[model samples]
Target: MGVGDVKRRIAEILREVTDEVWARVAWVAVDLTKELIRTGRRKIAVLADDVFQAIGLHKAVAYVKGLLGLIEYPPRSVDVVVAVVATSEGLTRREIGRHRWASHRPIWNMPRDGFIQLYGQIPGGKPPFEEVWRATGGNSKLLGELYKAGWSAEKALREIADERKITAFVKTLRDEERELLRRAVDDPDVLFTREDIPLMERLADLNLIVDALPERDPWFWAGEPPPERDPELGIGRHIAWQTPLHREAVRRALGG
Candidate 1:
């Protein structure tokens, strides 16, 4: 979808999923105020992905002030469009430099170290912009794609990958989100949701995990491990722990 459509869709989705509509409505009011300042009542909407890419410190303040000043009265449904751009491919240098908005400024060309310092001036967490740029060989779009696929710094170092999308993707998720995914992959029945299957399918697309079973049951796969009991501690539960070596062997078997 285009940027505007993406933003609108995210807003709509957020509203749909929100149990507390009033809280979200309040935020929308703030967003509308910002919109007025930035676009002079032409309808204010910010693409989430683009904000991560282009909106610098100075511009973000101006955008916020503009929006806040626009709202005279608070009790209303304010439309705050948030577009989270989740992609599979890492971004290219050119992609990062691309300006989708008319008022946005060109990225300043600074030495690597200096630019890192410049990034510190911006708010929010350190998004690994410089690190990803350097890691992906300066391909920003490709970097974004890797993020969408649940790949990590360690995994990225070991593989070359691409970008594709599932029908519905959550753009607001972050790198640490993989922990939840890992849990779901291990035990899918934990908490079921429509998004769970689509994301799981996407992981399968990345080839990080596969679906298969051995042709025949071998000794190890045939039965559970032996249970042990301690004399002092009677009838303690038998823990099943796969050692790193055993895990590696299984990984090799699985074509890791």
Candidate 2:
């Protein structure tokens, strides 16, 4: 059946339920509808049946409520969004959306107003501004922690590195992975290719390294500037330590 018909049917089934139960069911239905739209799925009937069969109506309602209760409230969401903006200052709204943790909500949807500020414009887009998301002075400590090193380049490095965390991370790496990290530490200016993506991605997942564009001019933020390209690094993204402290921590962990 069509999505509308499926919703009508579900509503009919839920009609006898109290307003509280109906509200809970409606909340889940909205989330499910969004997921279906996002995935371009058409089998609404199948989803409806599965939802009913997998968990009875009563239990499903309770489950969703439980999950909602577990979710930390608003400012936590604001913190995550701000942290991302702080670390990656030059990202466009579209680029920020690529981060899995960043919700579909607007960047300004924060507990405290004026948490983020735009710096300059980027050419050729609806939101023409590069939407350089920078945390205001209030979030300076967080900003410092995420983007500690370098003036011009958008280094995804953390300002402070916890040695114990680094040690634990090292223990989890395979010998080859450890060796690769050692190479990164030994050659901070190391260049990587497509062949290195898998390893680089692993390190990125561990928050040790990040793949980013080459450094921009320190003044680039002051005005609209053409994108910078590093011929030596070619067109591919460059890999760098997540933080200078991370590099130092890794060096110590690797016995450098």
Candidate 3:
């Protein structure tokens, strides 16, 4: 359906619901519609789907807006880049550009605001720290939550891994996928082959796992000139739990 039609239908649906229900849910759809409209994209249908899905997930509209406001609003390119770096540490600029929502422009020129740190300096006449990028401090916390939430406000709200939601989400996983999550919990460094790509991607979408490099110690960058190593050496990705709490919750759900 056309974007206008989608909006009209959403309005009609909202009107049909009681005032109490409308106060709780309809405003979310309305605000999301306004946000989508500002992007000038014909994605109202998708927004409509997300709105109801969010309601079904029992997400508060404030929770949804808070997460989206942090990572998906105006200047989304910068936030997207930040989230990419947040989720996967030790990424080179080239690697950051490879993510779904990332672009070369943002990678090259985005403001770091002290949230992002680039390591590995080049000798001369080159872009600073072409080697690896990492998100720092509270920015990392917020971005990691937003990223692990799969950029979905509904998912973000549920990321705390409440028992009921975790169980509900776990029930939707395929056998192999559950096995994979189990393996990851047992060995955060678990390796996967080409055949596992689709499963890994799906699990990633559910915010159950992330692919990341080993974290570098703060002392590694403490010296006068700081230690320099070949960024290529440790760039291999490893499967990891999105958070310790998420791991524990999944473990309980999997009965491990």
Candidate 4:
């Protein structure tokens, strides 16, 4: 079906469930959010924040417009706000993104799980899904970068290592950050130390690294004293290369 057809279908379905009450009035509010998400073109958190604002403005509009028209304001918009309010209260971004509110939102189509779930979605996804998951850490932007590589570990690594954007980003890095990347060339999971704190923050700002988990340290180190989880090393939050390809790319750029 065409996009218009899909939208009409959704509107019809909602109309049926709206019981001719306030829900019809809510159509505009939801449309506002859909437009912002489609046009604002932001990350998940920023999108969610915008959705919150859109819903608020929608509420004020519905109230004033209804008062002016001498019509009873709909209660359905309140239901929508309930969803956004829940997010503001404490819901994780993933949890909020999974709400029914996203039935027509593009966030659902984003690479939340990367190839772990999308390997079957796209044709010719030959590389192991596990490898892609490890390499990109489910980061949508990074996954887009490697999409042309078509799922081979070697190809993904090669693409990252040769990607112009990757090289340009590396060139912008400081010598200390480059040194960190060179060290992670083969040791992507190296536990960041207190000493590497500044460098880790610098790399994370560029999406080259991500917070991992303590369990990823090593089984052999099980008997060793667990390193103190310090905020400096992002303790309680494991730190590592966002993608193995990123590690290799930076490493190669540093002439490791």
User: Which one wins on TM-score?
Assistant: 4
Ranking of models by lDDT? 4, 3, 2, 1
Best by lDDT: 4
- For residue 130, give model 4's deviation from the true position in Å: 5.0
How much is 82 displaced in model 2, in angstroms? 15
Model 4, 78: alpha-carbon shift in Å?
Answer: 2.1
Q: 144-205 in candidate 4: lDDT tens per residue? A: 65676554557766665554366777788778777666665555445368777666555654
Give the per-residue lDDT digits (tens) of candidate 1, residues 61-85: 4444433334433234445433222
Residue 226, model 1, lDDT? 21
The TM-scores, one per candidate, come to: 0.21, 0.34, 0.34, 0.41
Global lDDT of each candidate: 0.35, 0.41, 0.43, 0.46
Q: Give the runs in model 1 whose Cα sits over 4 Å from its true position.
A: 1-31, 34-101, 108-111, 114-154, 157-160, 164-256
Per residue, candidate 2 scores C-alpha lDDT tens digits across 57-127 of: 44544433433332333212221211111122212322333545433321111112333332122123222
RMSD of each: 21.5, 16.2, 15.2, 13.3
Q: Which residue window of length 10 is worst by lDDT in model 4?
A: 82-91
